[model samples]
Target: MNDRTDAGGNPGPEQPGPEPTGPEHTGQPGQGAADGLARRAAAGFHRTEDGQVDVLRTVGGVRGLAESIVPGVVFLSAFTATQALNPSLVAALAVAAAFTVARLAQRTPLTQALAGLAGVVVCALVARSTGEAKDYYVPGFYTNAAYGTAMLLSIAVRWPFMGLVFGFIRGEGTHWRGDRRRQRAYAAATWAIVAVFAARLAVQLPLYFADQVQALGAARLVMGLPLYAMGLWLAWLISRPVAAAEGPRV
Candidate 1:
């Protein structure tokens, strides 16, 4: 009647907007599916003697840790000694390749080896393309940015990535979201990891801007395992209740 609505009280054409394309508008992977995935991941994974998450065991352990650090160390050491990009990149690649071969020869799982090699390859390519030593760390910076964003999104959606990953890794699938308490626990753990990723970017992004290759490398080395270990411990502690608590949120 006021030039916008009809006599029946329906609104008129002056307010017609586009249709919604949000989660409610689409049949995307909703919280229900995410819940299932997380449940599956955590099913078989039980706490250890030290009360650690079971999925934490299969994550490359000491060997995976070694594969992750050696290449960066080699790269930094080579560059420090020679003050050149090519040799340093070459050394990093060599170490990655050698690690791959060792894994293959030892008949150990090559997932970690291959992933380390791939990361080195990408970093070397970036450094070479830019002809700057600091650019070598660009890939890792972008990786942190991407992962941090994804973690934030996952938490925002109430389907925390930690729940999904642990569900799969623990091979128990997920029902954590069913309980408000467990849901909060996993969300906190997920955010802890997100903090680690974000902190890396926050610290290293400055060094990258300054082109302080040594400082960047040092930060990477220091923050890499130590920071992640802290996050892991935090996650373990948060999830301890999941193992001890009788059931989901109820």
Candidate 2:
């Protein structure tokens, strides 16, 4: 009369009760997928064996830094010195293309270099079409705004983006969400990123509107990698878990 049956319809012993499910259980819905994503995100960072994050590595090291900053520098310098949009665009685009080609020649991953090239191309195209050097920075403004808005939204949902990433980095996983202090700390960290984006907009938008290509480009350089590096470092610092206070040494 037992309902449990084997594949051949033979009577079978009662199956074990459903194993408890969660991050610890293989049957937990999405647990494996989430952990996989977390691992990949952590891998993207350059972490020391002890799990300390290297900011330089996160920004893609020296070559990566050059890839991100050089094209903009080329464009700005070329335009500022010559006051010619066509030549400046060409110079910038050439530098970006050179990076992609070099990565290809080295047989390295093309994701970052290709992306940088694409952005440079888009900016150059926008500037070329509009015939305004300032338009070169137009795409940047919207990009910052969009990122800032997305991070802000993540905080509003109580699932901070940095927390999600840092949680895995620190091996706390999503369990950090249950700790009020950790949650608040990560919220602050996420806010640091939002602030970076906001600062860029606040400083560069006015420059854009005023048609100050040289000043805008200069501001962009100052605020681009260096500012972002500082912000990321600050976030990492802010989100570090505080050690428990020692009790009286009895």
Top-scoring candidate (lDDT): 2
Kindly report which residue stretches of model 2 are placed more than 4 angstroms away from their true locations once superposed.
Answer: 1-30, 40-43, 245-250
Error of model 2, residue 153, in angstroms: 0.6
What lDDT is obtained when candidate 2 is compared to the true structure? 0.71
Ten residues in sequence with the least summed lDDT for candidate 1: 1-10
Would you estimate the TM-scores of all the predictions? 0.76, 0.84
Q: Give lDDT tens digits, candidate 1, residues 1-250.
A: 0000000000111111112233322334574565454544343233455435533333345665577778889999999999999999999999989989997899876755777787788889988999999988887776676777877898999888777655444332355566687778779888887888778878988999998999999888777765666676677677545434565311
- lDDT, candidate 2, 114-228, per-residue tens: 6678778888889899999998888777778777777899899998878876777676666677779899999999999788888888998898888888999988877876777
Alpha-carbon deviation at 37 in model 1, angstroms: 2.6
Q: What is the lDDT of residue 84 in candidate 2?
A: 98
